[model samples]
Target: MARIKALVFDVFGTLVDWRTSIARESEQALTPLGIAVDWLAFADAWRDQYQPAMEEVRAGRIPFCKLDCLHRRNLDVVLADLGLDQLNEATRQQLNLAWHRLDAWPDVSAGLHALRQHYRLAPCSNGNISLMVDLARRNDFPWDAILGAEVARDYKPKPTVYLSAADAFDLRPDEVMMVAAHSSDLAAAAEAGLRTAFIARPDEYGPGLGESAATVPVDVSAGSLIALAQALSTANTPP
Candidate 1:
């Protein structure tokens, strides 16, 4: 096979600990407003609406909109559901930007920096470019470019999201590896002819709720991004 020319990562779970970060942010931002609930459960409930909200755009039921707009809508829905719909615009917007402040996993920066020595790196997430940029800057993730839902104007599992990243580098699908924690994302990327890597994120959904490993076949699978970088380095080394 040709050497991997680029690695496109799934940002939310693979690189960042969104569950804890979102929950913490929610508690920090909303508790002072006298809206105290199970913040973790609130985070999960908000996240559960993510894909379905995007599916509206993907299905042409709604026009193309950035993930931030979708996030705002989802946040409102979650707030309404939790009986906390009385927030002002400023408060709502502040809560929405919590997605931008998600903390990266411990291995992410070092792993991406190491992997960048060998191959180009970018986030192939459902997150829009602004969201990606905020997260990247906040977490010190060194991405060569931003690619994903915003670039393709379509969410993942959509062939365009994966293929567009490869296209951005002027490379064939097989030359670009899609690195994600979700088996479904890898499967979709594989279907689009991109190489696939899965990093198990056991705490992505909060402890045991997250995926422990890929259930589908992928070109590479690792416990974390740093391990994947080491494994890839070894694979590329000559005996």
Candidate 2:
């Protein structure tokens, strides 16, 4: 493995339990309006909206909207689909902020703290900047920098976003390592010449990630962030 100077994490699934957090928050927010939807299923559908929503822009079906707008667009669609039409502005705004209340995955804080001692650690999520900042503060996510789709004004898997991250740190792609739970995410980083470490978010699909943990080319594969950190701490370039 090559030395890694920076660790850019895919925030949503890798470090944070976005699905659970969004679900829980949505239930609370919806309760006031006497709207009780299947929060878990709602969360799943909401997350499902993430990819195709971005693809809309990627394919030029929609203009370049930020992730926040994209998320809201999807949220509105799902809300209507679920027959939820009653919500005050205040309640609706809070619901939209569900992403900000994301709970960190187990071992996230401890591992990131350990790794941060030896490397630069930040978020490189498809989330917007304000969303990432809010999440960091809410969960005490201790990022040296908060990067998101806002930086590139576009989403990842777009090569441009990944390279934008390299540009942000004034480093070559090879000097940066992207840690993600999703193989597709890591593939983009790796193809950009960035190193990749896959920390298995085995429950990302809510329970048992359907596929086995044996996905390929993941330079370093770990069962948890803390364990991944232990490995990275020792794998740093010798001073």
Give the alpha carbon lDDT tens digit for every residue of 59-138 in model 1: 99999999999999999998888778689999999989999999999989999999999899999999999999999999
Model 2 over residues 1-239: C-alpha lDDT tens digits? 45568889888888888877888898888776678778889999988898999998877788887787888888888877877765556666778888888899778888888888777888888888888888888777778887757888778888877888877888888888888888888888899889898887778777896223736587788888899887775665477
Clashes in predicted model 2: 0
For model 1, state the Cα shift of residue 76 in Å. 0.9
The list of candidate 1 runs beyond 4 A from truth reads none
Local distance difference test, each candidate: 0.92, 0.81
Give model 2's TM-score versus the native structure.
Answer: 0.93
Best-fitting candidate, measured by TM-score?
A: 1
Q: TM-score for every candidate vs. truth? A: 0.98, 0.93
